[model samples]
Target: MTIRTRCGAWLATLLLLASSASLQANTPDDQLIVGMNMNNLLTLDPAAMTGNEVVGMVVNLYDGLVELDPQQLTHVRPALAESWDISPDNSTLTFRLRDGVRFHSGNALTSADALWSMRRVLHLNLAQASVWKSYGFSKANVDQAIVAPDARTLVIRLPKPNDPHLVLYSLAALGSMVVLDSKTVQAHAVNNDWGNRWLTTHAAGSGPFRLDGWQAKDVLTMSRAPDYWRGAAKMQRVVFRHLQESQTLRLMMEKGDLDIASNMAIPDVRALRDDPDLSIDSVQRGTIYYLAMSMKDAHFANPKVREALRYLVDYQGINKTLMAGYGVLHQRPIQSGMPATLPDPGYRLDIARARALLAEAGYPDGFDTTLRVLADQPFLNVAIAIQSTLMQAGIRARIITGTGNQIYGAMRDRQFGLLVGRGGSGVEPHPHSSLRSLVYNPDNADSARLTNFQGWRTSFYDAQLNRMIDQALTERDAAKQQQAYFAIQQRYDQLIPALMPISQMVDSVVVNNRVQAYQPHPSATTFLRDVWKTPESLAGGTP
Candidate 1:
């Protein structure tokens, strides 16, 4: 057969296998098929992965020391560790490992494996190492800070003064610290890379599922580990298919081919709201969407320019019209609903004010600049909106759109002028989580290379702000810490930060009613071990 004809036949086969004429859950009862955009899923290595997409996958493949309850984010649940305790001075943390757990390779899991996994993160110094390094752990002191006294005892000594509670939250919420099968991973290491390269396409974990196969930006499949310590995953197999186009995912979900679809555009999600056989799950996330200015750029270096740009954003309009399904209006650096979080500062679009500020900044007629954004929905739309408003104030902003790699790559290298993006460290359900990721820049020198921090990426530095953030993290008195956070936000605003918060993220996923026990987590650590699907005949029934 001709190549084109063969390709056509293959697509027809997939469509045929996806559904029947009746369309009452054509998927198998023991299997789950998920559709999502995999553009950001570049790696599966726990120590190297970035973005929430990879976190959801990694948690199912590897067990963390603990996990936050999906319903109550602050509540930590035991996972690999059966129990844990902290010293009186709050300088030491000790975890008791659960016995009889084995990795997919049949190797018995031990405390040494957990300690080795953390040490590997500091050694690799990749994307996942950023948060750990911020906590004072380094490649040099990891062996001393994190030690395995016995096969069942894992202890961690703080290298610096920090809230042990926040450290515990980090261990539970961030998938980067998940325990790995040290032996299996070490066996695959190449050139002393600590198995990073090989782990990109393989997994050595003790979670409920084991990776079966993966094709980058295409399809990934995992099968339930038969000897999982907790219990076998309800689904015999789970498949994640990359469906970049939102409409394709909607159609597949409507046809019963996909049990769940994530990262779909807002309009498509709205279209399926009335579907009797489908349900929408909206999970509030700690991440924030905002407009970032690069201080390295001459136009935004001035505080007046940054303040002018902040007022140029139509927060209400964008959050009401454009961010309906994606996020809610949130202005403070800290996430909303937290006790430490303050109300929105209520900055609005005022072209005249922006014009006045621009004139004061030595640009009577605003200068031209470029705005970088991902080609994906919401981001692209928000950029367009900002571009229009910027032009109104005589500031011309050209929109440059590309894939996540192309866009974020420039931001990471500090080569962008202006960018509309989403980020914050809200995974741990703590106020410091967001401030540390978004506002804390410990080192201002370029040589520091703190690319993991958005503050560093934007060249936004303030000695007092850094001091307040550091003080807040270690402050033992809850009342004093709360006041410290308030003072930090006030100072951040007065200084005209390079990054402006526009919206707090809310992730909406369309799920087939046939799927049960599937709860999406705020931290993006969705577990599938308890998720199961009803038989096809009863798929249309209420979940």
Candidate 2:
């Protein structure tokens, strides 16, 4: 039978078995299945796909040079490389490789391996620029990466002084700097490309888990790697089954079939909160939901028109009614708590102001436009509310809803005039990546490539962005970084490319109490390596 059919049958069997077992008290040794409403997984190649599903998988399967502590924000800890040294000039960095680490392919991870991997990532030109953008390496700095005499040491020479965050970006986050086994890749080259068909289904990392099997749009099964650089995973196997329907996911969670679940709909989230049998872990994440306007489109080209649309958003109302007070009203594009950038309260609702701005922009009689929305109920509700608000100012808005990828694709291609979508500054949040990916040209060639839908580019904005990046990298003084951040924020405020509504949205995961040490990361990605089934629970005791 097909994998999807097998998974479906497996789930049905589990449900049936669990129902019968529930006649008596349940035990924790049962499978800890997790449910999700994710529909955006395309590839497992870290350098190829930037969707959350791939990210979720990468967090579990791979290790970076550095990683953020799951419980804290902005703290960095070593992962692949045990330690490193930064040169006095701030241009060159040397890393001390961890000994005895082996890739899933059984090849020893040497300094040469690190160098080869870095070279591949630097040259591969994946669509996700955020991976390497922080390293002060652009198309210009690609040649700066150098290897030392011994294969155990790798060095990255920057054009100028670099921000420490650059290191975090390359080693952490969804950037393309993931190290791979070059020999294995060459030997198993499907189309002579590491990121081609073979790598898409197979994994060859030094991580704790190895890809055993994967069924597209259905289930992904990973088993513990015996030779992982760290220790082996406590659990022998992990299976990711695609349960796109929220109700099905909730039902599974209630039936004790799931160990973890994520991306629950807001109402279902509320319902789960009240269930005494389940424990829900919620965090206000960096993911922001907003309306992306096409600057190239004539209807939204005018600054006043953009301002009018921004003014009509009832952020407070949406937070109360739709989101159930779950998310915060986000203002600036680069989220709060970053080193640089001034936070603005953003545009508030003022129907009079919106009307006046529309009139001033020569749309006194209003205009007809389409607002493309995602298929999700919450996003659709927000779009409908926006449509109604626009109508108050004589603007006729047609609400269009489609699957997440379909709507997102339309927005990226600039096929839609306006789109309701979600984006973020990212885990290792930075302004350069956010600005370039969404508002400017995305430098990568993969799915994460931020297509500039508006087709808006200006030398003035470009120069300012470059200056801000230079200052952030070169300036060691706190005041100077803050000053540069303020200047960039001011420029972005005036530019006003996207209409941002909610800054940080709450993402909740329901985990069984038997699952010990299930800490959530600030970036909203879970680390399954740190999780284990409690001893008492494993011994057939109730959690």
Candidate 3:
């Protein structure tokens, strides 16, 4: 057998060594073994990493200037930055760097490194740069807009009007702005690539842990950084094994082989609820699950048809049944619990209303269309539920399921008729975050290529809605901004947006009872420095 295959077999044998009858935890007390699917872990580069799985890992391997408190998202906490201040005009932000911090490469951390990191993000123009670009930061302007006066001080001058608090939230909540070891990355730079090629598999960071090795789609291992500014991580090492099969994870967890399991199937999570040694943490994420229609397609372009599709969704039934551990019913574009979030408009599955609207839109008998969705639950299950409801209104929707890339790829290209997907930037705990991502489409032309914004992907454009979203984000008064957001939602609903919100996303993570201080953040920036596990002998079983 090949070396990789042999290694995989050996690991599998070790994992299988543990059995339920033995009831012994196979993991070491000083190490945290995490079972998860690592398919979406494409890169370690802070500017290019996508998905929550990578976000959780990146946060531990690198330190952002600030971080939002997991319990209170609005409260920004200091990290690399000892403190910060916003100018009275809300156009400038200044941050003071903490002293004595050093990167894994032993290079001293400074505001120059921070400035270089921010500039590199825009210069690279990768996945993480999109949000910063939307805030008027560009490769050309980054040098001027973001500056460092001394080794300890960094300043940012906004290119346009924006809420400084939201900007701070972006810096804290979004892992994209995390500072990097510029000297190390530059040393590894090849072909003037800014280390993008190298950082894909390597890391130059100053967080609680240092990247030891990463084998793509197989395993990722990191050990605690002894000289971490805050302190060394409680766990000596953290091993994330690629356990794609939910059943395998469940079996391993039952045998005490895994300290934590994320992205478990809902059914599997439900089965583990009664397990005494396991605890499920249902973290409420800001992203929303929704049904999207491509306005480029003639069928969905009609306002009446879009309105008909809204009434055709069985939102209540789907949330009550299919979305048990996946999500909760949420119809508005804005996520729930936010001050600006309004009550659900109380849309129900009204086949009659849908049929009448369809007829009014010149389709007496509902036309045929394809509904694309991920080939995973509860996306597949939710798509099936939607298909059944659409059929009730004489609308024939053939369900097409595929991998995330295949499905979302078609949507990004504006080539899909209908799609069941989950997205929206609730990372900052701001209404504008959701609106900017899901509803504020500045341009609908295919050439605009604002695929980062779901609004552009679905070809859902409204100048007035865009203006309102922009105005709300820049509003100085809190109450007035909230009112503006409320008005935006009301108007968005009245316009019958092509993207229909069905539920707010919830992520369930199963953890061993012995694991302590393991709080999962809503923004996906989960810090593992303080997490510890009880000793096996003291806990009466493996931890």
**lDDT digits (tens) for residues 1-543 of candidate 3:** 454774565455445433432555467788788999999999999999889899999999999999999999999999999999999999999999999999988899999999999999999999989899889999999999999999999999999899999899999988998899999999999998999999999899999998877889988878789788897789987889899999989998888889999989989999999999999998999899999999989999999999999999999999999999999999999999999999999999999999999999999889999999999988999999999999988889999999989999999888899999999989998888898899988888889889999999998888988898889999999999999999999999999999999999999999998899999999999999999998877854443
Worst 10 residues of 1 by lDDT: 13-22
Local distance difference test values of all predictions, in order: 0.90, 0.66, 0.90
Expressed as tens digits, the lDDT of each residue in 278-309 for candidate 1 is 99999999999999999999999998999899
After the best TM-score superposition of candidate 2, give how far the Cα of residue 328 lies from its true spot, in angstroms: 1.4
Error of 2 at 250 (Å): 0.7
Worst lDDT run of 10 residues, candidate 3, spans 13-22
lDDT of prediction 1:
0.90
List CA RMSD, all candidates: 4.0, 4.4, 3.3
Tell me the lDDT of model 1 at 98.
94
Clashing pairs for predicted structure model 1, backbone only: none
Off by over 4 Å in 3: 1-24, 540-543
Across residues 394-428, which tens digit of lDDT does each residue of candidate 2 receive? 88989888886688777656567777777654455
Which regions of candidate 1 fall more than 4 Å away from where they truly are? 1-25, 539-543
